[model samples]
Target chain A: MFPRPLPEEKPLQRGLYVGFVALILILWLLPLFAVMLTASKTADEIMAGQYWTWPKHFNLIENFQAVFAQTNMWGYFINSLIITLPSVLLVLVFSTLTGYVLARYNFKGNALVFALFVGGNFLPAQIMMIPVRDLMVSVGLYDTYLALIIFHVAFQTGFATLFMRNFIAALPDELFQAARAEGASPWQTLRHVVIPLMRPALAALAILTFTFVWNDYFWAIVLTQSDAVKPVTAGLNNLRGEWTSAWNIVAAATLFVAVPPVTMFFLMQKHFIAGLTMGAVKG
Target chain B: MSELWKRHRNWLAPLLFIAPGALLFGTIIIASSFESVWISFFDWDGVGPKTWAGLANYRELFADPQFYVSLKNNVIWLVMFMAAPPLGLALALLVNQQVAGMRFLKSLFFIPLVLATVTVGVVFGWVYDPNYGLLALIFNLFGATAPALLADEHAVTFAVVVAALWPQIAFCMVLFLAGLNNLSPDIIGAGRVDGARGWNMLWHVVLPQLRQVGFIALAVTVVGALRSFDMIAVMTSGGPFGSSEVLAYQMYEQSIFSYRFGYGAAIATVLFAIMIVFITWYLRMMVRLEKETR
Candidate 1:
């Protein structure tokens, strides 16, 4: 194995690896620290410089109050939750079922269908953007939450299916066959057998999808205008405009938009990394 | 009733599961793409009556200088953005060296992806802020008045692309780390025994096995750059007289801002055509690679 790490080298490499990860992680989180610090700063102090100094007053409450009072902050948050929750649910259910079907069933054009979904997964949003937009408008779904949900679920389905198929395919077929022979119908098998087994992947997908749908800016901006349907990403844009001069309030609002996904990423960091890196390693 | 349910359940259950996602996908993605194409052939403002444009929209797109500028910027995006994968791979290879608190560093590097886009935009906006920003701060340190990277015609697109590339490169690095983790030690052992080492071993042995992951990394980066709508929408808003507009941002401006639904659709159609080439080829390659591995 090109020699296992020598006894002496083991601790050294371990130390080295940990140090490297720490440095890189800090660098990655630097902008976030800047954002957080700015959010807590008074506008006057921010303009006066010494941005590195700890805030004397931590005007976070006042700034947040002003942000909510002046901007579409709450509207954006509600919009994001409304749009993201249903779409996440839809992607999870459909993708898992589709994966289950293609994995369990030896049907016609199975490979072709799987390929379409996988291919669509990687298709640039640019390709789907125009057509999807036009279709939404023609169908009278534009400027509505449904328009946003439809696009998010449809597009994300591609990636979700890719993950699910291989996972389902890789499961020991003995389980599926034994259940089938024992009079377990496909529906029953899928529900009672496969669905329970798919919990880990489903958990990963749900969290990942939530972050994606919530962070999404392009579709949200295009499909909805009024705060009635605006998600946080677009709301931040509007917030930037209204709080144009109040850097602190704007920063606070941006932090609020950031917190949910950031919290999800931190809490689910391991699963996030694992899910993202799936299919990455090769023999 | 139970027997009937069981008998029909086979097709019906999957369909029931499939229907919601499929209906949504069909209506929004597939149906919408087609609608955009149809709309592109007409001359319809979003809220107004439609006029038949035939191929006129396409012709206008062909003749429009700004369209070419946008397309050219996309080309620049596509080509230069390819740098992310190799850079990420290089970084992964470098930092994968085990050391103290390497964990913290790895997570730290990924912080850009976790930050709010508005924050990244504003922070970088300050970083590139024409006056009294980080860029300006550097210029002051050097005793020069800095030209606004975002405002300068020649520098604007490159500046935005660099910002976009920040998170993407980190993403690429993670992919490579995942690839490296799964790299077979057995193969490396053989290479070492055969007197291969270091760069030669990496290039001849390690690199070849990493092809699939590499392809994937490249494809994702390209797809991201092509659909790049954020930094442009935020930092400069495609300003400095629209020198930095790529198709995605332009499509937004056209449809949403200008309310020229038909023209916007046309731009979208063109972007879609370009994307199809890359994504189809990526899939075809991945499938072929998968088959070869099998």
Candidate 2:
């Protein structure tokens, strides 16, 4: 209301304003629109330098077939699922425990532990790349799915713990007091009080972590080299190298790679934004 | 065992709950960070035995011209990325109204943040493609030729940064939208009663409440800029001629392709040193904010 909402009675002015904003939105998403357009075009049209025109052949299905046929995109997509789902699950499990302890327990070194989680989340990934790679290699987990899962779970726990800790801390303290009075143990309190209340937070965290782990390209290259273990982001980059001039096919592949996370975002926009703004707007 | 657990569950449960997360984070994130710093002093190919090279990597890093270029490009990323928060705030304000289908429109605007940076980079690379790109199409309409942005050494960093900024701006907009929603209705009502409207109302009344969210946006943007590597890799691969390399990508190039893990660790250490300054500032702010909320 700070900008003063338009009067509900002023249909003409409101319609014009909405129309103007819609126009700007189109301009903003023009890049994505162009990609979608390119994805529908035939390879022959792309080679003919017809980027913006309507696809005469509408070869989207053929391009989709080419994406699956010419590359291991489906396998990479499966690998991404194999890596991402477990990483997200582990992050949630670990961070819930960590967040609960930091939020409820009043033990020594609590602040330091909290600081470590918060600070570690902020550090650039390159700072730890070499040692992590070496550690994965030493453990014989290199070029495997577990390497990515373990590293992602470990790294993402830092941020997830911060988020979950803040959220759990903000819950009404009287609930804990009541639980304590009822002779409920910490586990009981967690199971009865925290987990049920954490469904929304968990949902948000799950979506955010899924998007992050799925989109990770750096560690994919550093820890895994085989096409068998590589995620779709890395696979998409590999396809970029293989199909340099086939923009239509590459564009189609790009859309394929983006489908999962974008679908999740649209499906869970509320939770996604809630999770994002939990840290940004509040703590 | 059951009897003992009943008695000591309070003290023991906290430890059990914290151990897995703490251990994993300590070993992988904290320990690896320190180990990389330690590795910077040794000469190793990441596969061979380490020879104590004490400051050799750093010395070479200081002398290497590509190191300077990378450092300079990092500065460019840092400076250029500062635009996200303001532009994001503008977008948030533009779309903050409660209207029909606004929710859908808002979600549409957030599409970029959900898309992979690799996807965004590839799309933007096509956008910058000179011959058959969207830019070329636009320029052709005006009878002007488009510049091949990703191939020009001077322009490649800017081009990649622009692509990276697409998602970053969406992120900041989400933050600001949340901040706007949480603004005090009472204060806005009071401001309206006082006849404050438009920019005057925003500057004097609303802007003060947005300071914390703005600070968070700024910190996130700075961190995002420093962490810029994936886009560079997908788009330019730190080219043309390493002109677009930031410290993160340069470290990857040195360690992975060149097999100079020691030198890469040194570069990582330098980047860590720079980030420590911001990290310290960010931690302090967060700690202070927590205290204020408490």
Candidate 3:
């Protein structure tokens, strides 16, 4: 609407705009298109310089199966799930409680505590990298799934709390007042009233947190070493090293690593966008 | 017992709610950050005992040639990444149209964002492959050879930055799209009545309203550019003798691969010091905005 509708434009100008959009979209997706095509091709076809050609033989199932069967891809995939799910749940619970208290209470140090959470969210991971690793090593949790899970839950709580607090703050105060008038306890009010209303926010945060922890390569590499505990992101890097010339297998594995997050994004596209653009847009 | 519970619940409830989050953030993020800074003053290989060597790591870092290269690459990333916001604005305007199939088109554009940066890096690395890459294929059509982008010292950083820009630009576009959706119809109607159309409308009316979104986009982009590590690590590993290293990756390499924990902490501290400037500005803006909302 701001650019003026294409219908209001001259026919030629409208055509040009459509064409330009199509061009950019094609250019933007070219690499991914290549990946998809390459993933379906055989190693012979790929090595024969038929990179752009449609695969003479479709090897999709075989290539993907090989990715799982011939490598540590399965272990990596399970590790990712093991790391991501608990982290998401933990972050949601912790941040939801923190957000609820911050939004509803006028306690001492409320603003300072809120600021600390928000500020901690912005610090570079490198700043905390050495000490966090040392702490994990000292606790004998290095190269384990728990290390990544714990770190993610802790770090993600900052952003999740910010999001949850803002969301809870925006809910009508009359709801709380009505609950209080009914002689309901604060815990009861939260469980019965706020929890139900927080469904959308929770969905958004869950998907975002899952995607974040799933795709975390830095912590995966830092904390976990062996294939036994390495998530897919870092595992994919290792696979790349192992399968240097086997681009098809690597491509298949990359798509496999990407599937969960991509599915979540599409399934919850609206909430995903809402979660990401929460503070960017003014009311 | 019930009377005591009622009396304490007011304070107790909030404290209980805040405690876990505060404890986690304090120990993991805050305490670790300070510990890292403290560790920067000592010489340690991370397994053995740490020896107090005040400022020795910093002095070495100041003289290290790789540190300068990483710093310069970081500057390049910052400058290159500035293109995201403007490009994102352009894409937002384009796709913000209510044309047929626009939703599908918009979703298609968002595909890269759903993938991991590691995925993006590996895919782009193949795309830039000189022997059998998409770039090579394109060059073949034109009777020219494709340069091995990730292999070249001069082009590796640019190559990695471009891959990182893919998702970053998409992110900015999403931000601008949200901003564009929330633009007031009344203001646009008024501008239309005043003969504001085309560049006149965009430059004076549209862009002015997009100031906050633009600011957020810029800040996010700056922070992202500064924090870039995954793409470089995946694509090049700062190869060709460390030509493409940024400070984050350099810090990781120094600490983890090279067993220089103290030196890595020094690099982390410097990166933190640089980031605190942006963090302060971002927080100030956020606090002001929060105040306005209240």
Who wins the lDDT comparison?
A: 2
**Alpha-carbon runs more than 4 Å astray in model 3:** A8-20, B292-294
The model with the greatest TM-score is 2
Which lDDT tens digits does candidate 2 get at residues A134-192?
99999999999999999999999999999999899999999999999999999999999
Cα lDDT tens digits, model 2, B116-213, are 88999888988898988888989999999999999999988998888899999999999999999988899989999999988888899998888778
CAPRI grade of model 2: medium
After best superposition, candidate 3 residue B54: deviation in angstroms? 0.7
Q: What DockQ score does model 3 reach against the true complex?
A: 0.76
Better candidate number, 1 or 3, judged by DockQ: 3
User: What lDDT does each candidate get?
Assistant: 0.77, 0.92, 0.90
| Predicted candidate 1 versus true structure: per-residue lDDT over A1-283, tens digit per residue | 2123334547866666566556665565555566677778888987786465689988888888877887778877988899999999989988888888778777687787777677566555654665666567788998999989888888898788888888888788799889978988777888898998887788788888888888888788767777799888888887777766666787788888878987888788777777777765533
- Per-model TM-score, in order, reads 0.91, 0.98, 0.97
Q: Please give the lDDT score for candidate 3.
A: 0.90
TM-score of chain A of each: 0.89, 0.98, 0.94
Error of 3 at B194 (Å): 0.3
- Across residues B1-294, which tens digit of lDDT does each residue of candidate 1 receive? 989987798777766765665566556566666667788888877766879899888898889888988988998888889989998888777676544445656665665676655556766775686655556766888899988888788899998888777788888988887788777888888888898877888788888978888987887888888877778888988888889999887877887778787888898888878877876788788778878777
